[model samples]
Target chain A: MKKFLSALGGVILLASSSYAVNKENTGCGLGYMIFKEQEGLVYELLAVTTNGTFGNQTFGITFGTLECKKPEKIANRKLEIFVAENMDELAQDIARGNGIYLETLADLMNIPEEERPQFFSKLQKNFDKIFSSENVTSADIIDAIVSL
Target chain B: MVLLHFKDGKSLIDDPSFFLSPEGKKNPYKELQATIRAINRNPYLRCKFPARAFFIEKFLKINLPKVKCPELDKFLEEIKGEKISLIFADYYINSPASMFGHTFLRIYDREKNVYSFIVNYAAQVNDTNALIYAFKGLFGFYKGYYYISPYYQKIKEYVGIEGRDLWEYELKVDREMLLLLKLHLWELKDKYSHYYFFHKNCSSEILYLLGILKPNNSPHVRTPWVIPIDTIRAVLDKNLVRKINYYPSLLTQLRYLSKHLKDDDVEKVINWAFDKSELPKNGSAFLYEFAAQYVKFLYYSKDIDRRKYIKKYLYALKLRSKGGKINYSIKPEGYPHVSHRSQRFSITYGFNKVTQYMDVSYRPAYHDLLDPPQGYKKNGEIVFSEISLRFLPKLHRFTIQDWKILRIISLEPMYSFYRPISWKVDFGFHEFLNDRGEKRKFLSITSGFGFSIGEKITSFSLGEIKVMHNFDGEMPIAVGLRIGLLKQGKIFSFISSISSGKYLKEFNEKYFFDYSLRFAFHINRSLSVRFKTNYQLVGNKASFEPSVSALIYF
Candidate 1:
């Protein structure tokens, strides 16, 4: 319950602040806070994350938008962006219990091409839970994938 | 003269520090020969001999035999690094020598991995006493040298032990520039230079090193003092820095973890470490992970011994494996580059008990209690040349109020894991009321040691002692004991101290109390206002003075 409240608070804080500039920032957020961690806000995030490489280099190694982010995590990030960008198409696709975008995401997640039918059926059933509204964000998508 | 010219507009090397046979200014070739001869006589100078040799050949028209170090050559081959970067270790106020912070250079291998080698120029002193080191540093009594060590060694020292962050900037230099840099570094191999705390220190020396490659591009600070941040900015202004990275200190990382961790969960980990008999169950993965990292940090910082902590470290790891995978990555807040500059100038008009006066003040050096907190270490300040001038309108009296030579304050906060003592030292000249009720100049030294709670918005209680002396012995030395409270907030920082002491030689008891409040609300990044009021109790008489001032920064 405490975790739930903190997550709700974080959602409100992020929504209110300039941190809303980037939707890709996930992972820690309120989840880590409830888990005994403080996630840096987006504005404060860059300040704390990377150091004086000044402008040219980044920490560890760069993997697109995330540093040292693994391939599977990248797929999850892509899954979130794809769904948010095409919520209406995804809604229609899930209503029929199948879609091309879902198929592409599944491929990225390394789901077998043959299992697309059953996968879409399960996703379609969980669509409302996955994204309840226009306010539903990428973090919710990542949570759905890890839990699903 | 030629050697001096090559050294730059004005050489940082003081004459007494030089050991060459023929002085540098008299004859350039002879200076090169002496340097080469010294290099031949000593193996200690081997690492730096090559660059000096190349420099002499290029500028002085002297073709000296190339210095060789097969050992270093093979080591360089092993590293295979093509790029170099400048590193700045944040100020460690506990040690006065590092109050302005420290800067060094690093060589990155072709892999460009974080792990690299560090080249540092610092005074060679084995003194463990902070006071002695500070005294020597103030006088330029110690010799400075360049030494290379592994990057992790620096991290272990600065980050873990001293609790300071390290920021690194990669310079955009071509292969030719890189070669010139290497050659120039060798010139100073066995040479010693006077290390001035404000002017010729580590950061300034780094500027000289860069000047060797791109002399025109190095934006030299006109001031006598060169702070590390100024050097970083100078490099940026010259377009010398290509990239930047920040390596957070151990304390920062721990705080990052602690902010997210629950109080009980963190307590369990601490209890488990202290009470070795039993390991706590029902621990989450995040707690275990934090425990492991925290333990490792403790071990590296030498707060714990590996022999004793090994079992605990391994236990935390095992617990973490069971806690399952979790992402604990944290993003930081805003860039430090947005903070205000160091120098501050203020002008104010006010009415004292006697008359109305306008006061102007300038602080040339650094952080003071009333200064903004951004881009500066919390509770750390070094102030120099804090001069105040006052002009009375009714009496037509224009006099110097006070001139503070130097003041150093370290307010290291006490945390759950660490307890650092807070202390301060102040020395300067000020005008005080004499027995005749006239303003007189006197030299005073004030030193205090006490405990402080909170920072930025903190309330601190401290005991202090001060001594005042008049040169001609008209008034005997006065000593006093006092206590004070300081509560600093975003717009207002107030301090009040009351004390009672006697002039033993003068045969009198003098008491003092004053309250200072500064309001900084009407301000942006570059400007602010200080509305100050002071209530002072001298013997049986009390006086109240209020002042309003506008402060501007460039």
Candidate 2:
């Protein structure tokens, strides 16, 4: 009985060692988000890079370390655009919007609660430049929110 | 037991002080001072006293012995300017081992104030022990003189010193000590004079130590036994004259100076010694030995410039005998920008609309079965315009190395259709009939390339331009290219192309360009799913067709 237990322990040790070796090697994490509003599916844009952005008027998001399965209320995931008249202008707008969105994310994540009011006010001014349309999809909103 | 030959036809132990120290308390320093004082105090001691005393003592001791002496004054005059040769009285010429063991000797020439120690044969003794004894003697004889050796510690040990002052040490020797040291010299002479040249099988350290303990006083002045002039002549001949190259070493010089040397052929041995060039970390020990021997050889060769030889030898010693170690080589360079030599395989389909259609040309009242079959119906008038479909599978195997240099060649086999798949009577059959009712099998041979469309996630490729000659009635020429996009797991790839060519016999030429988009999801190494879509433009027509393919990567 002791011999059997010894053999079983040896096997378990070998298996655990192999598992630890495998756990050390993991590639970059990529997540997909589906953006569906009242209308049909628009264009799906992948959020390859991200941070956070300000919203129009008094509304804005506070997206913390965003994940797809349990997305934060602030901003996360890819954005879809429905009423873009041209693809070239839309690509340019999204690229510019993502930059500010990521900055806002870094500010909110790092700033103290007392400084949040000032941070949000500054964020609002930045968002006014890119928020040309009101009918923005969730993917678009997430892009704009995290990009700043 | 002293038999002295007086200068004036008499025998005497003329210089008694030369036999023993004047202050004979078994101490060398006191005796040295007393002997010097005796010489300084007596003004006549240099010439008259020694000559007169030697004649009187010889007359008394030998009782008018029959042995005749040359006139002492004339003998003295003749030998005055000459170097005094040392004799080894202790050595037995017949006994090889004894001659070798006690080979050290003292030699001195007073007139020239030149002092040197000479050893004839020193090819035997304990290696390490002999060196220590040599250092001890050197320290004893040359009082307060600096002596250095790479093997100084070993010498000290041989001399039985636990620890010694390295920076400063005392060396003081008197007459008796010098006399005792001269015994080794006499042995060297006895050993060399009889042609019983020293054997060389002894350890190298012993020979080196022998050289070190060489005495630097002349025996002719201090002792009765002076080296015979015959022996001197022999030494000069054996050691100084060289057949080709002169090796500077007292021991080698002595060996070469031997009149009846047992072995005269030393070329091979010398060459062997020259070849041992391994740079052992402690290689200085060997170099020091070589330097010591070479210096002595230079000393004996009166004409040879000693300093120049020493400088050259030292330089040679510093050079490494052979390359020490090896290093890794550099990597190869200059690769090509495009790898046109990779083996590839692709299958593509082309679809397009044409001007000739049955709906536009057909208006038949009653069709006769016997009439030549015009496949399309347009107002019942027989009408035919150019329309073609091509399906090509091209495989290219190529190789490339440098960017500007390429040797790429490929083979592509293709199958073409002039009509749509719906119009074919037997789309899947061993043999099919064409518009002329001739049996046709669908396949052609061609060559092309595949290019990537976009990002790694998805790819589209168009193969290179290809020319095909149909094997039917007119041997119609068909040109084709393939396009494909493949994504296997995380990898995405694409290929697309277009080609046009004509057969020599047929005036009508067929052109085909197929663009395919393939997204292959590679599950693992061996399996992948390929989603493919192809758009073909033939002449002025275009069509969009999609296909699915599974790929296996080995």
Worst 10 residues of 2 chain B by lDDT: B417-426
Q: Report i-RMS for every model.
A: 22.8, 47.7
lDDT of 1 by residue, B1-554 (tens): 21232444334555433435546545556766678677667744545445555555666666554456754454444333568777878877765567778888887743223344566777776664554566788788887766554454466467655678877788887776566666444344455677767777887777767776575565566667788778777777787877777787767777777767788777766766667435567766566656766765665545665444545554555454444335444443423444567788989999866788998989887777666666777767788888999998877887888888878876666666555667776777886654333456876666666667664455554555555666665444455655555554455555555555655444245544455555554366567777777665555566677988888765
Candidates 1 onward: DockQ, in order: 0.01, 0.00
The TM-score obtained for chain B of candidate 2 when compared with the true chain B: 0.20
Off-target runs (Cα >4 Å) in candidate 2 are: A1-148, B1-441, B448-474, B478-490, B498-507, B552-554
Tens digit of per-residue lDDT, candidate 1, span A1-148: 3432343333223222121112232321110000101111111222212222322232211211232223233444435433333333343344345434455456546687688777766765665565454344445555665576
The global C-alpha lDDT for each of the candidates, from Candidate 1 onward, is 0.58, 0.26
- The reply for model 1, stretches above 4 Å from the true place, is A1-148, B1-5, B8-72, B78-80, B110-114, B129-131, B276-279, B293-306, B321-325, B328-336, B395-397, B431-442, B472-507, B510-512
lDDT of 1 at B291: 75
Q: Which ten residues in a row have the lowest lDDT in candidate 1 chain B?
A: B1-10
Total clashes in model 1, counting residue pairs 3 or more apart in sequence or in different chains: 29
Give the top-scoring candidate (DockQ): 1
